[model samples]
Target: MAYCAIAVIVVLMSCFFNRFRPLGKMLVIIALLLPQLSKAQKTVAPLVLNNEQLPVLPKEFYVAAVTDERDDRSAVAWLLPTTEATSITPQYKVDIKYGAQAAIKQFVNYAIPPDKALRPVIVRIKKLKLAESLLAGGRVEGKMEVALSFDLKRAYDNVHLIDYRTSSIYNRIEGQQYDVETLLRHTLEAGLIYFNTWINREADTNIKLAKGVKLIFTDYTEQPEGDTIYYSAKRPLRWEDFKAVPIGGKYEASVLPSIGYNERVEIINGIVNIHLAIKTYLPKSASWVRNGSSTNYSLNHEQRHFDIVKIIAERFKQKLMSEKLPVDNYDGYINVDYLEAFREMNIMQDQYDNETSHGTNSYAQQQWNEKIDKELGK
Candidate 1:
């Protein structure tokens, strides 16, 4: 019995040791792979550009005017400096009028997943009304108006009335603070929806065909004689191509914020006035990508640039139409103070880029201008 007991004990101990050894080895392997796994997880594929992403811009038929603080007057209400509305437009109000529409359009782009099916996503905005007056000291002291703006020519069967609302009153207070941040946020939301509605109206026909914005290829040659670089789009852009491409997205689709290009422009004005040649450049990592990947953010950034430029160009043309100016030649196109516009656009783009927390330098601005000077026979 004693011999048998010793045998059983030795066998059990060997089995236990064998099991623990494998577990220990597994733990070491996991420790070794943890860092590599983390790095691999961070690797993202580049965005794929397809026909669907191409932006289709409106022609001479489409025109828009945005006169901030316009002369449209309704019922007049005055508030003393001591007593002003503490609130801006209500969150629900803005959401109903414009926010919901913008949100819906964004959701449609990505297609709300099955898990999000129950959640109500904004698709389009129709009617907006002032539910209640934002009163000051229990008295009506401000004019809060919402105007529905739409591109009459482009909007189709399902017309989304993009609302332009304001929360301002003839207040005796010169600089009265009335929930300014909240007001601004709502204003921005309204602006985005209004702009996108116009873009959607213009782009709806082409959106189905567009996979992504087609990049404008550039050709650059160093001129040794002039000590300059000549640049142009590899292919010339004609007005007829507007109908062939997709133009915008849902929710502020017409414009996108940028940094590199903005910084380049700033560098020019800070030193010397210069021209600019603009085209999309592919990142090295992106050159290999053939399919769309969320990880590949560069492709998305470039697409955004293309989309914004398309919208701006359309708006520029619209402005020209209003002025009864020709939109045919390079001189006419360049006549608009595009430098100032680029700066404003850059500010918006930089803010958006900063929010993404991506480390990208804003030097596209500097190179673009130098390239343009070469085209101008400088």
Candidate 2:
């Protein structure tokens, strides 16, 4: 019984040693790797940007916002090329003094201001990375890539104006890491100087930088060969132009005429030029006359209606030519003026018909004919 008990104890001790043997090996391996793992994960100190290195621009611009849009925002550069002794790689982060966004903003603000009165712009840092590779003969190669976009800030949105991309390559001895900051500062300065030169050249002619609006009036004229007749001082209305079927109404004759405009916009020398082509037209298919009422007198009254439309078009042109339109909402102001002119056309036509009783009142008709002719002569 004693021998059998000792045998059972010996087997239990062996099983316990086997179970704990893997755990002891794992602990030893972890202890050996602790120092190397910690070193591999270590980060170098952040870079510092030199503000005095930036250049002043000819035309100042406001830096409204700055954003870092790189895919990996955690690190801006990788430091310490792999050597035979140490193969671990370390990352170089943003500037410790100002960080990425703040660093760029401060650099730009040194040359310009944050004032809203200046030309406002936003800067996007698309790519900012510095990479190093160990080369033969104890030399290290450093390459930097930087991409930036400039946008103009408007009332409700932003307009992209320009883009700049640049890359630089340099060679140095293994321990010369200070070139990273110098290279970064010089590259940033180059981008700003490029933008400044571009804006200075473009400010006078680019539509996006227009400061005011201008109005140019033109009369719409076309060949008198189509179904539609464009109003002209020399082309008077004839009785044969009426082609539509006469509707059943108390009036003996009817004419359909209207006023409208076509617009063409162009910018010249930092001014928005709005060209308006005024059109006063009569559609022959929509005008009709009773067979017996086609008298010179009755025709004269219908022509006066057409003349009323032309006069209103002239008045519309005068109104816009006399006022200063805001550049931000010039189209809206033009639409308002057009609507007012349209209402005026309707009221004037109705008043003429009401006073003349549809051309039956002889004295009133005669008075309208003279009034219409006088306005047209002007």
Candidate 3:
């Protein structure tokens, strides 16, 4: 309770020392919060980042985050027994502490590349407390606070202290209106958003999983897919997936197939483990139409475009299997090869459109379909 009270004090006076207050305020707050800790504690195992979901955040700079600072080993950031709610979608069992460490861990790991994740940098999170206030109209104002203690060589970590916070007021009903777990998840996101603005690059935590089950062009067996968006063009493209605006002249539609990839290297026991992946993205929002006259024909043409990207991604993956990059500066190493391959892919995409006259040349379109299929087969 004392730590919770300290969190409230920090939040209430956050604006007081916006410039230099964070440093001195922490010292004062910690001194006051030690007496109110609850004796009984609950523990939930730390949540682990999925191997594929994790990336080497740095080719050079590495990190391993530590989220637990509680002396009692409890993981629930803040617990409230109030069950008054209007709705509860998926009710988390009452009295059980949800794993807060993993919640913020998931938030941070997804925000950076693999190299950075492995950096010696330690992001120690402490004093994560949540509080709520009853307000007008039976509304409840929830406050989430996390004291982000880090030796971030980056200015984002300052002597002044990096305090993360987010709050919201929601309509209160009865019977645990909604899952507090869900709200807490959103709070972690908001806190990270505030933390990243000055500390690291901003990132989105709500990105969809990047695998396209039906359209894989290559077998990705050895490496992990960290931030890749993989799609297969072999199966064919449905009319529903192409939603990009058509800007090319005289063409009713355009399928902008994108092949993207990234590489990471870790010198584990002097043996460099190269983690690389290449995948295709079929941008639904950026692809659209003004005509459905030749829907089937146009779709086939677009499918070919997508297939071409898959072919390139497959080729890129193959290149990684054989190529040996200089490890002196891994961050700068793979760029040379991948960038060239990317340019070649774009060129081939454009060449197909030009030779087929945006699918108007039926003979050439048929020729391209066969050629790309043959290459893909090989």
Reference-based lDDT, each prediction: 0.33, 0.78, 0.53
**Candidate 1 residue-wise lDDT, 262-373, digit = tens:** 1122112112211333322222221222223223334444444443443343333334334432211223344554554455456545554454333143354333334333
Model 3: what TM-score? 0.39
My TM-score estimates for the predictions, one after another, are: 0.18, 0.71, 0.39
Predicted candidate 2 versus true structure: per-residue lDDT over 188-249, tens digit per residue:
88888898888878876777777788888887878746888888878888999888889998
Higher lDDT: candidate 1 or 3? 3
Count of clashing residue pairs in every prediction = 25, 0, 32
| Overall local distance difference test of candidate 1 | 0.33
Which candidate's TM-score is highest? 2
**Where does model 3 exceed 4 Å of error?**
1-229, 233-235, 245-248
Q: How many clashing pairs does model 1 include? A: 25
Instruction: Give the poorly placed runs of model 2, Cα more than 4 Å off.
Output: 1-43, 53-56, 60-75, 81-88, 113-118, 133-141, 171-173, 223-227, 233-235, 243-250, 318-329, 343-357, 360-378
Cα RMSDs, all models: 34.7, 12.4, 22.6
